[model samples]
Target: MFKLITELKWSPDGCRVETIPKGEHEDLPERAVEIAIQLSILDQSTGGPNTGQQPEQPEQPEQPEQPEQPEQPEQPEQPEQPEQPEQPEQPEQPEQPSKKVKK
Candidate 1:
């Protein structure tokens, strides 16, 4: 069976953290310790300064309604045309007779 142990150590000023392996007494690498310290600082600094604050909302203006106009009435129709007058009749003249001579 394999065994693993993890240990955490904090600096005196509370600004840094160091991670150590304790089972076989092996020293942790410098890069791992530095990363742990940076993560600790970030966790401590977040979420306290901006608590309970809301962003401001912009105000919008209301629009006015326009009134509608009334429609006009239609025009009257035109009158029809009148009928024409009848023409007068003319009289005819009599014909004259021809005379004959004796032999």
Candidate 2:
């Protein structure tokens, strides 16, 4: 009496069609059991040579507390830029030689 972990469908003797739902089957034929084993759909404790991936186990219910991140080092305040010195006034250019008016 093996358990079919997955659905099975077949037509025995090319006449009687059968569909076995997943559950314990008390009267499954030897050939049907062999097919189930070959298909890796039988409920075997060893899960013998299964290639399909199993469902992942759920994560723990309680999440671990995350450590508080250290506060970023306070950015140093930028120094105030020094005021530029005022420029000295330029001396007036000497007057050009007065041009003699040709009357």
Candidate 3:
């Protein structure tokens, strides 16, 4: 919430305040301003003229709820290896014929 503007002038007999913030006008202070002028006209007829900002509520606030986790179990399958037997091939031996004795 932001919006303020308290200005008044008339010094000499009494009155010369200043608050500033909304829009700002500045001239320095009036010295002691404030003898009560309907509370500065009820702060300028309440809201709207501030123009300094502050006023836009719609709706926001809601988020809290999270807790749930439990489920995990599945892994088992491995077994297959058995097949090897083949060996038969051996036959090659025949070479002997050489005789010569005559001198």
Candidate 4:
């Protein structure tokens, strides 16, 4: 029976690392395809697939138009007041009234 093993290959810049086989190069492509399919399934189950997709919207019922209210009429202004009537003004009363003595 033939066995396959994979190893990581780092670039000289160290910015990227890729998976490579230790011996068999031809099997790497097949393994990569399988891994990609598994990742896609995982993404769909976890709702990650819809992260960039538009959200599903619920259907809204149509609303009826509301009737507009009528504006109120402006009120008329009152005439200006004339000179006040002359009243018979009385003298101011003292704080205490004088008491009458009994004989």
Determine which window of 10 residues in candidate 3 has minimal summed lDDT. Answer: 28-37
Best of the candidates, lDDT: 2
C-alpha lDDT of residue 4 in model 2: 85
Cα lDDT tens digits for candidate 4, 3-102: 2233434333447667544433322343343343333321223333334444354334458878888988887886766689658898988678667687
Candidates' C-alpha lDDT: 0.39, 0.70, 0.38, 0.43
Off by more than 4 A, model 3: 4-60, 75-103
Clash pairs, candidate 4, are: none
**Candidate that scores best on TM-score:** 2
lDDT of 3 by residue, 2-59 (tens): 2224444334534653444443232223222122222442233333333344324422
Model 3 per-residue lDDT at 39? 42
For each candidate, give its TM-score against the true structure.
Answer: 0.16, 0.39, 0.15, 0.18
For residue 40, what is the lDDT in candidate 2?
Answer: 73
- Cα lDDT tens digits, model 1, 1-103, are 1112344454534587654443332233434334433444212222332224332332233467667666667667656544654456556555555455666
Candidate 4 segments whose C-alpha is farther than 4 A from its true place: 1-52, 56-59, 76-103
Candidate 3: the clashing residue pairs are 15-33, 16-33
Model 2: residues with Cα > 4 Å off, grouped in runs: 46-103
Q: Which residue pairs clash within candidate 2?
A: none
